[model samples]
Target: MIGDKPAPPVKKTRARRPKVKTGCKTCKLRGVKCDEAKPICRRCISTGRTCDGYGIWGGGGNAYGSVSRITNSSRSPSSLPLTTITTTTITTSTCTPGPLTSTRTLPPLLGATTQHEHRAFEYFFHRTSRKLPGIFDSPFWSTLVFQASACDPAVLHALIALGAVDLGKATRELACAAERVRGYERVALVQYNKAIVSLGVHFRRGGGDARRVALITCMLFICIELLRERFKTAKTHLGNGLKLLGEMRRGEGGRKRGGELVVNTELESVDDYLVEAFTRFNIHSSLFGQDNILLYTIAPHPSCADHAIPRAFTTFRIARLYLDTLINAIYNLAHQVASLSPASPIPKHYTNTQSHLRSSLDQWLKAFQTSLPTLTTHHPLIAPLVTPLLHTYYTMSTITLSTSLSPRDELIYDSHTAAFESMISLMRGVFETILSAHAPLGDEIPDPPGFTADMGFIPPLFFVVLKCRDRVVRREALELLDGAPHREGLWDGIMAGGVGRRVVEIEEGGSWGDEKGQGEVVVPG
Candidate 1:
């Protein structure tokens, strides 16, 4: 009876992992580890799986991967989900056969408190959204902010405030801060206060999507401050918004989708849009080489970076975006080296990064110059409007990369005389383009009277005059800068011109214009 070859000695096995009930529904269905990153999980994204978010909220977790709603006085225990394993799963949590589809839980727009509020909301939807975003045509302005305002009164109030105070003309005025407490500014101020109160109420009640609401409202707040030239306040808000976004990403293991948060649905990813908008604002701040600009580690050199450029860019928009990233990388590397090298020798890694950025920029120039005609194929306006603006930055990036390792040495800048000449030529082209646009050929002017979120000629011109000792080149750069209207992010063309003039006339002990002077004067090696 006991025969059977001793029953193969009873095969041994390891214990199975515990079933993750509190994990995202998608993870449960697929039998994979859920990083449980809020809104969406990292494991799902990296694996190309759609995170169906979490099941029903149990004892206050951020349900369905929305932002965890933290209260005014205290943090929600689940506000920051710092771990992959969750403690607050419904005991009866059920996973459906496929990804479950639930109606997004946004509230309908509430009634306007006043007729003025109603008018202001419509004004924003119709006019201000188009006007405010400028060249930085972000969906956050045109779409997501409006969507959030419809559901959150705080955002609604802020939107009304933003519409009431015209930002397109805000940067143009003088004594903006002193004048903001009266007249139409008073109307905007009232709405701004109301928005703050509404936001505070959400915190106290612990109801509605307070996090997304707060973030949207925060952008409005930043815009209001920036418009009024209250840059310090705007900077503070930008920092806070970025801080909150960092928390949300940390909750998601620092992974985010490309400006959309929802999965298997058309709902807006409020976090992605907000993050993008904030990041662009931060990146543009580097246009002036701001000391507080966020420093990033230089990427390792690509093996064939010079040959990496395509034969032609498919579209102007794609080309523009690619070039912007390269310039920003240069800005980031310069700042990082400046910050890091002072305390010690310039790291070899930074020097290597400088070479990589220089190589990429060289290829960018080659590709861009070759494809200049194709720039306006799809979007006819892009070439005339932004080509010159971008060229200046490309040249500025070259200068920055070359001098990044020797920031304080005035002598190092002399080597980049050709780069400064390139900026002068680019600025001349920009002026010519704008003048031709305003030629009044019985036709409407192209790109008139508006601000852009894109960094424009002001920064490059300012840098050229400051860095280039060739008086003739710097004078022309200053004049070109002075003639242009300023409305690009934090850069003011007139103000930059004044600063550049001061650097030449007062700081360098040089006469105005210094005309008929030798150009591109290179010192002996």
Candidate 2:
């Protein structure tokens, strides 16, 4: 009777609500309710607990877990995430936790979007631009070229290609493995191909602006090739650019009947600037090659005659144009002399040309000297940097002109000796200046925008080491070369210096036979 009564008196139990899962990590772990405030939860703040902010995982959870936990895991250390921590204030509950994970990958090699163009341009302006200090300082690279590139797809591509090459070179140097270097090189090639395709299209279209852009692109390609040490390729680009300039000149005066201007209908300041750059390149290139073809084809600009040195002695830019003209004339004469048969006597025209060059050189030096005093008072930095370079070039011009004028049998040893002495003296001045400024030797020095070291000292130094008879002077020049490692245009200082050192070893080793004592050194270009 009792068991039956208990069964009939059983009571109903009420349903309980599911436990709410709401709170910051701190409050949740503490088993307390959280206000879920914007930043620090009110519950955690009131309880004096630090708030762990939220991230991609809700409730401030760590997806990869804590750094300590990851480090302690059984997984290999290399498998761990490459994390970089940066301190940032958390102002909201939704804020990501800890440091940011870098997800931004390098752009693809074949990418040719506007974003990539801008990135390439920035790389060029900051890094590669300094390699061409004087050229970049001018309005062309700094302003006009960029403006043209903005609208001209071909020019933009060419610029990006050059920038890519520079970046590749820079990265390749830092790369420890061959595969990494290859990767960068591939990227450079991709950009280079894009530029070439765009340039080809512009050339086919044929207009005045297109031609101008083509000329600029060709020049840039030459630079790219030279940096890669593809001398033959660089020469081809140089030749093509020279041809383009010729066409532009012809089109300017309507010389060709019914010939329309290809590129732009009218020339701009940029055209003149590009022509000047080509002229400079022509002069520099002639130093290594025997060709006087460029000299004959490209006439000097009329402005080269304006030899008035600025009172500040900062007139090297203008002065160099005139100096290059003189140097080119001398080089052509040397080429002519070198070509003559042994039986042939020195021509009257050779003597006349030598005399003319000497006279012009003297006039330039006189004006240059007159401007020197201005440097002492007005330009401390200019005086130290430019004085030695100007003198070195002057001495080199004199030596080259004088040596070429002499017959093989009757070498002008005295003139050679004097020039060598002058060169040594000037170089000493350069070293002294460098020491005073505490500048790094050669390529170690940083070349910011508008700042480039004068590379004029290299060729002359190399010449001395190869051709000068004085052992002491040769040693000094070699030491300078050994100390400085730089690359200016196509001239690589370290490579040149190494070659000079080898030549010295050959000479010292008595490999020259009878020529060693005779001071009859014949250096191959």
Candidate 2 residues 119-147, lDDT tens each? 45556644454445432123345334443
Tell me each candidate's TM-score. Answer: 0.65, 0.65
User: lDDT, candidate 2, residue 192?
Assistant: 74
Which regions of candidate 1 deviate over 4 angstroms? Answer: 1-110, 113-119, 167-183, 201-210, 256-270, 293-314, 340-343, 366-374, 438-450, 513-525
Clashing pairs in 1: 39-65, 261-269
Q: Write candidate 1's Cα lDDT for 215-301 as tens digits.
A: 778888987776666777877787777666665554664343332111111113445456556656766676655444232111111
Candidate 2 regions exceeding 4 Å error are 1-119, 134-139, 173-183, 254-268, 290-292, 296-314, 375-380, 407-410, 431-455, 510-525
Task: Rate residue 25 of model 1 by lDDT.
Answer: 74
Worst 10 residues of 1 by lDDT: 67-76
Clashing pairs in 2: 207-262, 207-263, 208-262, 208-263, 208-264, 209-263, 209-264, 210-263, 211-263
